[model samples]
Target: MIDIKNVNKFYGQGDSSFHVLHDINLSISEGEFVSIMGQSGSGKSTLINIIGFLDDEFKGEYFYYNHPIHEYTRTQFSKLRNQNVGFVFQNFKLINTLTVADNVGLPLLYAGEKRKAIKEQVKDVLEAVGLPDASEKKPTNLSGGQQQRVSIARAIVTNPQFLIADEPTGALDSKTSREIMTLFKELNQKNKTTIIMVTHDEKVALQSERIIQILDGRILSDKKVNA
Candidate 1:
């Protein structure tokens, strides 16, 4: 569903510039669960941003579902992302002030969905994430795991075709992380959601069907995992 080639990303200009990603090439198929593993500053997050259409300052080619993503305008990217992508960050990016349902429905609201439809979608996603009773609660009132579940619920509420998770388990305990991974597995297996996750944890990466390791801004390895 995604293809990239010779991608290079840099910060700053001319002499003061620092390269963040270099000559990256990859292709991910539909219904595949892939993990990007790298140390801090190894360009894992940068790659994710590029894939999710969040970064457009780099030099390279990107094609999503045969659409040339590299040439999309800001508005085009926004529309495409809203329609096809969902994101989960290491830090639960939920608004502390919004109720769980509101947080989960933000994307649909921004897309101009009607109130009744948004509410139904939010309710379904909450139940899917095992958070049926969390709709009226603020994020601050939830535990770490519950908060992350809310984040996941928000990401999947739109039924996006692709899910991008960057260190999604970074903030939770091992048990909680395992629970989150189980949820991810169910999403991939049952929902056929294409998942591309960036994680430094090998154990977390192993849960994916494929692992891509990055080092010094380059892809070090890409291999399928044995079940």
Candidate 2:
């Protein structure tokens, strides 16, 4: 569902330039689960940001479902992300004062869905994430894993076609991380949601169907995992 070719990203002007991505070429099919793994400053997250249409200042051609992202306007990108993409960050990014249902309904509310529809969507996503009764709880009341689950619920409430997660399990313990990863796996398999995750953990990388290894702003390798 994504095609990127000869992509390069730089920060700063001529003499003060720092290149973050180098001639990156990537293609991901719909319903695929993939991981981008690298050390700090290795450009994994940068690449994801580009793919997610959050940053389009790089030099290259990006095609999402055959539409050229480089030609899309800022408002177009915003609408694309809202309609088709979901993002999960290492930080939950939830408002402390908002209830779980409210936090999950933010995207829908922004899309101008009616209150009754928003409430139903929130309930469905929360239940899908295995948090059926979490609608009324504040984020602070939940544990780290539960909060992350709520974050996941929030992301999928719109039923996005693509899910981009940046260090999604970074804040959780091993068991909790595994649980979260398994939840992602189920989402990919059952819902056919394409997932592109950025992570430093080999174990987490292994959970994906494809692993992309990056270093020094370039892709070192891209390979599939055995069942």
TM-score winner:
1
Candidate 2, overall lDDT? Answer: 0.93
Per-prediction backbone clash count: 0, 0
Write the residue-wise lDDT of candidate 1 on 82-152 in tens digits. 88899999999999989999999998987879878788789989999999999999999999999999999
- The alpha-carbon deviation from the true structure for residue 110 of candidate 1, after best TM-score superposition, in angstroms, is 1.4
lDDT of 2 by residue, 61-130 (tens): 9999899998898999888888889989998889989999999998898777987778877888899999
Residue runs of model 2 more than 4 Å from their true location after superposition: none
Q: TM-score of every model?
A: 0.98, 0.97
Judged by lDDT against the true structure, how good is candidate 1?
0.93
lDDT of each: 0.93, 0.93
Candidate 2 residue 218 C-alpha distance from true site, Å = 0.4
